[model samples]
Target chain A: MIEVINLRKSFNGQEILHGVNLKVNDGQSLALIGGSGRGKSVLLKHIIGLLKPDSGKILIDNEDISKLRGRKLKRLKERFGMVFQGGALFDSLTVFENIAFPLREKTRMRASQIRKTVSEELAEVGLSGAENKYPAEISGGMKKRVALARCLVMSPEIILFDEPTTGLDPLIGKAIHTMIRSCQKSYKFTSIMVTHEIPDIFSMVDRVAMLYNGVIHAEGTPEEIQTSKDPVIHQFIHGELEGPISIN
Target chain B: MIQILTLLRIIGAFVIFVIRETGRMGIFLAEAIFWIPFPPYLFGRVVRQINFIGVKTTLVILLTGTFTGMVLALQIYFTLSKFGAESRLGPIVALSLIKELGPVICALMVTGRAGSALAAEIGIMRITEQIDALDTMALNPYKYLIIPNLIAGVISLPLLNFIFVFVGVWGGYSVGVGIMGLSSGTYFGNIRDFVTGADILEGLYKSLSFGMLITWISCYKGYFTGYGAEGVSKSTTQAVVLSSVTILIWNYFLTSILVA
Candidate 1:
């Protein structure tokens, strides 16, 4: 379980997050939907302890991750997995090496064992054969899958996805959605995914949270958000210009 | 006056931040170095970095070091000969090359070749959130990225300086003997006479110190990059400028304190 309470963050004096509050139960997927520059990424960073909150606590598994530091902080950080939006694979390492990275760095597993584990994870992602190739040689969707494999290598309890399907075509997007659903079903890990695509929310998500006006404007089941009578949620879900929210 | 004081304070803050961060890096480096004696080591990455950083720059360091050594020897020889103290040229050439010129030149060459590129690459990784991704996955980026880079730099710079001094003094001896018609034996004997245990240690010290400074500055810039591409360019530029300036400053200080 993870809880965010009155989280506020600012960059260069311009307040980005204004007292946001959220929570995710165990083995659940909560997609935070908002427009670009809506502090979705900021909130995600704070939860991962990437961006420090100005005030408030981000509690992961009953521990306040915000106050942790050094090796202790790093240990807490190890419990979470983050897939950067652009499929941030290390270009220098091959796909096999990339997925094997966390296991080698963090655990005491032998080389042969590591090799077996990496192959298994790659197969799980449906990317078994491309292990020898560099990130640049692969497709964008494949890179995301590799990132996903790397994320799972550590067996994290809570996974954070930052715009996973942003650049891929719709066909690949559904495939990615399926992959997400399948992984969640198997692992039963809590997940917080930041995304803009409505279809993704409709097809796969169990619950949705709408972030607007620097706070969670609405939160309910996917069905509830889609059928929301509130002007802000309705306007946002329909991608309309004129509503209770301004263009800015 | 108030504005100046505020400006000075900002600069002081930045310096303090650099000092603290570098100290943290040094502590991490010490722990990692301690692990070097343990078994199951991988020298593949280290060897690759050495080849890329040291072996690749062999010709450039040689050319620059040779010219510098030759010029220093000739100028000192001419001036000392006019004073009927020509034999002092041997010690002067050896002292200057070992204590000052070799390390400075080698560091500058690397700052130009590898340091700038390192900063840029790191900056890109930081901005693109790759490093952060690594961190979230329970990986010690210090182990994977910092240790290899720091070790490669520290080992390579001194070896590079050794090459520089050898090539440089040889160039000087050849110029004094072949081109300027001085006796070859006399030129060789002078460098040999002047090179002491202290001089060799001083050069090695300078080489290692400058290597640490150059690599750390570049790494730090890249590690904390902001503002995307523009930020990356800024960090690379800052890494080169600061490392180059610090090298010259440290060379002067080390020479004054150690050699004097």
Candidate 2:
């Protein structure tokens, strides 16, 4: 479970998020659909404790994580697996070490155990034989899967995917969506995915929140999001330029 | 009063930044040092850096060492010759090569080669988001990136200093005795008389501190580098500049403190 209250953020004097509040119950899948530079990634980073909001409280499992610092913050961070916008795999490390990273860091599992767990997770992601390859050696879709495998390796209770399908082809993106739905069901994880792929996310999400003008203008189920009377949300969902959203 | 307050505030912020960054580096250093206590050592990465990042730059070190020794010999000879003690060239060159020239030259050379490369590599890693990946897995990027380089730089500089002194003294010897037709007896005797245990200790001490300085600055700049590709290149250049300046500045102060 994750909860954020009145989250306000600014970068260098420009406000990005203005009093945004949201929450997800245990075992819920929520999708945040927004245009670029709309604070989705920033908000996700705050939840991950990678960045702190100017004012707001982010609670994970009822613990305040927004202001956590030092080693304490790092330990809190290890609890959740995150698939970044890019795969973000270490260039120098093999896929085995990449996925095994969390297990090795957070647990006393030996190398043999780590190898076994990493392979299992890789297999779960359909990347079993690709373990020895580096990120550069893999396809974009495979890299994302490796990232997801790493995220799920700790058996983390929650997973955050930032634009999981941003750079993938349409077919690959659909495969990723299948993986998301199936994995979330199998793992029973509380998932918050920040994405711009409205249709793919709408098809997979239980609920949706549309961020606009530094606030969540609408929150609803998939049908409510598509048919809502809210100009910003409707225009974004419909990909229409005739509404309040500027063409630029 | 406002000027003084502003100055104090700037200093406060700088101090805080250093403290915060230092703490980041320290936590990482602790984790890295802890892993050293266990089996399946990750020194493979460290050894790669030492071999590629440190050893591959030997030619540059040799070039800088030889020229530096030659310059020191010329300067000391000119200054001491005026006092009709031109024979002091051997002693002056020996002392300079052993104490100051050796470590400082080696540090600068390594900074140009290893320090810049280390900074750029980490800076690229930072810009490319690879380090952020480590964070997601609960693996500390600072530990994985900074500590190994810090230890490598710390451990490598002294070894490099030893090489620099040996080659630099040989270069100085070549110029003073071989090229200048000075007798080997006078040169070797002067060196034997002039070099002391304290002097050698002083140079090693300066080298250790210089190692720490170059490694810290380069690693910090690279670790926190903000921009993208442009930022990586900028940090690389900045690392060299900062490391070199820090070395020169610290060399003087450290020599004065530890040597005098």
Q: After superposition, how far is residue B72 of candidate 1 from its true place, in Å?
A: 3.1
What proportion of the real contacts between chains A and B does each prediction keep?
0.78, 0.69
Model 2 per-residue lDDT tens digits across residues A180-228: 8999999998899998886778889899988888888888888888888
Assess the local accuracy of residue B44 in candidate 1 as a C-alpha lDDT between 0 and 100: 76
Q: Give the number of the best model, judged by lDDT.
A: 1
Clashing pairs in 2: none
lDDT per residue as tens, model 1, B102-210: 9998999999888898889878888777888866765555555555667788999999999999888887776677677777777778777778898899999999989
For residue B130, give model 1's deviation from the true position in Å. 1.3
| A212 Cα displacement, candidate 1 (Å) | 1.2
Residue-wise C-alpha lDDT for candidate 2, range B138-174, written one tens digit per residue: 6666557766777777778888888777777778778
Q: What is the C-alpha local distance difference test score of each model?
A: 0.85, 0.82
- Model no. 2, DockQ: 0.56
Give chain B TM-scores in order. Answer: 0.85, 0.84
- lDDT of each residue in A162-235, candidate 1, tens digit only: 99988999989878878988999998888999998885667677779989878888898898888889999888
Error of 2 at A70 (Å): 4.7
Docking class of 2: medium
User: Interface RMSD in Å per candidate, to 1 decimal?
Assistant: 1.3, 1.5
The TM-scores, one per candidate, come to 0.90, 0.88
